[model samples]
Target chain A: MKNIFTIIKKEFSRFFKDKRMVITVLLPGLLIFAVYSLMGTVFSGMESVDENYKPKAYIVAAPQNLEETFSSILEITEKPSLEEAKKAVTEGELDIVVVFPSDFSQTIGTATPPDVKIFYNSAERNSVYGYTFVTAVLGQINTSAFTVNAASDKFDLATGRDITGNLMSTIMPMLMFALLASGCIAVAPESIAGEKERGTMATMLITPIRRVELALGKIISLTCFALLSGISSFLGVILSLPKLMGGMVGAEAAAFYSVGDYFMVLAIIISVVLVIISAFSVVSAYAKSVKEAGSLISPLMILVIVLGMATMFFAGNVPHVAIYIVPLLGSGLAMSSIMSFSVNPLGFALSIISNLVITAAFVVLLAFMFKSEKIMFKK
Target chain B: MTEILKVENLKKSFNLSRKQQKLEKTYQKVKVAVNDLTFSAYKGEIFGLLGPNGAGKTTTLRMLATLIKPDGGNAFIDGKSIINEENEVRRKIGFLTSELKLEDFFTPNYLFGFFSELYGVDKTTAAQRRQVLFSKFGIDKFAEVKFGNLSTGMKQKVSLVISIVHDPELIIFDEPTNGLDVLTAKVVTDFLEELRAEGKTIILSTHIFSLVEKLCDRVGIIINGQLIALDTLENLTKEKNLEDTFFELYEKTTGDRI
Candidate 1:
């Protein structure tokens, strides 16, 4: 027991003494702050359409009173030929072009609805807004044409914004998982394979301590470092939440994650850190050198990033129960679930329990490897 | 002198692919690394197992250290069977090999503390023992220097100190002076004499015949995974010098000119 503690203490002290480790711990926080602050500034500086409301419209056959009806809303432009108008729309010079056939009034008078061709470039970046504005203008003209009472339907803009906020909430936890995996990869391999390469492992092993105890002590220390990185990332995302929400939807969308939600996210993040550290421990043991260990564990970091993004894109529905049982993916799904405030107790419990089990199993595997003369004595 | 360490008909074999000798197929056969090797070291004696490269001396020492299990035999350390009671055997032995490396990030003092703790030495006793060992070895002056910054000789001294921190009954060193300078080598040889005076059993493996002739009470020669000769240095060198005796043993085992 004392030997194990001594090894653990020495490992941690060596970690702190390395300049690379200190930079690793601080770099992520600094990067998150810098990146989000820049994003916030860019988002706040965007010019809204409401501020400059000049509605450009193309008229084909100018009705005598058409000018009067749209006098306030429309900015009348010179009627160009069809080819010129299409070119203008393609070039984004015109919002939408309305073409009236030769029998415009006659077509409207008949029972058949008049075919008023609205030409706009759908490939244009802001074409969706152009289409919506054109539709609103047409509706106003119809309302004026027939004075029958028309009921206005109120659309809840908040629902779409709320879903987006929920998506962000799901994304934040997954990001935490990725950060933990990255941090673990950066440190765990060196803890084992690096020591072996440096010829320190044999020195530590001959002590009266059991190999399993040493393995466990390393796992515990790594878990602590991984969890610290996870929490730091969680806090980074949380601090930037208001700014992200404001830019993505609006201020009202920022209220999705409360203190309770934060706590759950934190719990999920810690579980995720454990799972990653455990996985890295196995890889580290298999590696013959620190470089080899890094290569072995690099796939894990990539997997975490991919899983986090997948969880974000597929927020509401995780595909299968089997995914929740998979090592790193399970933590990601559980974290996403917690962030969305849809806690499945069974899934969460399974993730935590499975992580612990996997960690224990890896520690045992490392102990066995440490005992192997083939591995330990390999030149 | 009482026998403190013994190896009886010890043998170790490793799987070597034989298909490469014929076709390019992948089949392996057992190749003996140490074949029926037997030797013993008594208390207060410096025993040397001398051999050229690939002579199974290391394999023999490793078996005695309980680092590896022998294929066909057992070793006893302080009356404890290495095969049956490995932990007890390990506790009673201090094993070192040239291949064993130290963590370079630690100072000698830090590493001493670590090994002392692992040896189950209490904090106060460990500190006292560390001070005494450092001073006696003349390592106290640079005890705070990191192992990486220290010379190879200093590192060897530190390795020796950590190996014997618990003061085991049997000390095993493989190629202890292989890479040391003349000065450092002399220091180590002198230290081994002091350890012999203190009644500790010392088993060393070396390729240097002169050093073995000077230090060893008894000498054993191994070649091609077999112990070819075992006797006191005087008897082995009765009619010839130690070099001629080594050449004769090598020729006898390998059927080669020396």
Candidate 2:
């Protein structure tokens, strides 16, 4: 255990003491935050403009009685014909062209409802909002008239649910996994195989420490450093996620998850990081140089990415308890479950146990490889 | 004299792949890297294992250091078996070679403390030892400099200090002065003599004849994975000078074999 701490201290100092490593670990998160915040600001600005700015509307055969209602919301412009109004809308001079039947107000409360034709550009945000707003306004007028005649009570119901949380839960699991995997890839190989390539590992091996202790030390040290990098990247994404979502999902929806859900996610992240670092350590032990280790680990990184993406597809669905017995896949499912607010304790337990077991197995394998002179001193 | 290290016919063999055999232009697939090599080093003496490159000197040293297990037979370091009690063997011996390198990312001071801790040396004792070694090697001036930034001679000196950080009884160094300048070489040779004077057992492998003449009290000449000759330098040189004797043995062995 003392030897393990010694190794961990060495690795920690090697990483944190280096200016370049600190920057590599932190820059991604800061950049993600800035980019996402900028996106959010741009989107919010567009939304505010869409809400307040009156879109130019041309109403053909306007009813005199309803002119007062239309005057407040729409920039009403006169057009000679329905064709001319549509041409103005299509040419972008008008946001929407509304064609109301000549007897639109008179026909209300009668046998048939009047046909109203509205034309607007669907590609433009303002134009789309203009069309929906005009139709809703006309419908409101019709409803008010009917309510007055029938003496009915007005009804309004709203639910305090965040629909965007579901979208975030579906996407965040995969994003988190990819970000953490990248963080591990950036540093773990250098800590292990780099020592071998530089011939420093032999110096360590000749010491009085047991091979198992050395392997344990390396694994633990790498786990802590890799976990920090992963967390930094995760924070970048999590803090900036609302902005990147462009308020399509309400920013408040990100806070909808309980604190316990975050703890559970963090637990899964740590477990996943241990598995990743251990697996990379084994690959590094097998490699002759840091470059070779990187080449070998690239395929494993891709595998992690593919497994994490499975969470996106499986979001909102309950995963089988057996799925949580797999390493990377289980962590992904567990995280997805937490974000979706349907976490299963048994699944999380199994996932954590499986990850730890896998990590231990890899470390043992690395220790055994360390004992083999041919492997350790491979040309 | 106390026998600090003993090798009893240690043997090691490696299977040459088809490609390796082809590259060597040989038909034998199994090559014996170390074969029935036997030697002993006493306390307060420098034992030189002299041989050409690929002559099993390193293989022998590696076995004694417990870096690789001998295929047959065994060795003892301070009475600890290389095979059965390697960790204990490691505690008794300090092995240095060109292949065993200090990490370029670390400084000599940090590595000294790290190895001392691994050897279970007490902090105060380690600190005292580090101070002594740092001053002895002139390492105090650049104690915090990264190993990679040091000159080759400086790196070698630092490596030697770190190897013996725990003050082991037996020291194994392979070609300690292989790449040193004349002045640095003198320092290393003088240091080995100084350690010998202080009653430390030292075993070193070298092909340099002058190094052997200057530092070795005893010499073992190896060829083709076998120790062909072993004796004190005075006894071996009684017939002729050591160089002529080595060449004569080399020619006789090669002429008889091929």
Index of the highest-DockQ prediction: 2
Residue A290, candidate 1: C-alpha displacement in angstroms? 1.4
**TM-scores for all candidates?**
0.78, 0.82
lDDT of 1 at A281: 82
In candidate 1, what are the lDDT values of residues A1-379, reduced to their tens digit? 6656776798787777788886786567556656664665554312135524655666677455565665566676764586676557655576656665556566555665455556654323233355566567667777433211122321112232344445455566566666777778878888888877776776566555777888878877887776766666656665665565445445444466577766766666666776678778877877889999999888878887887666655555766666677766676677777665676677777777777787777778888887777777664
What TM-score does model 1 score on chain A?
A: 0.66
Model 2 captures what fraction of native contacts? 0.75
- For the second chain, the TM-scores of the candidates in order are 0.94, 0.97
What lDDT tens digits, residue by residue, belong to model 2 across residues B90-162?
8999998998988777888988888888888999999999999899889999899998899999998999999
Give the runs in model 2 whose Cα sits over 4 Å from its true position. Answer: A34-161, A248-254, B256-258
* Candidate 2 per-residue C-alpha lDDT over A181-300 given as tens digits, one digit per residue, 9 for 90 to 100: 777877778888998898888888888888899999888877777777777877876777666655444546557778888788888889998898888889988999999999999999
Per-structure clash totals for the candidates: 0, 0
Residue lDDT tens for model 1, B1-258: 699988889989876555532443435466578999888899999999988987888888878876777889888888899888877777788878865677777788988887777778778888888888899888999999988899888888899888998888889989888789999899889989999999999998999987898899999888888888899998998999988988987887789997
**Model 1 clashing residue pairs (backbone):** none
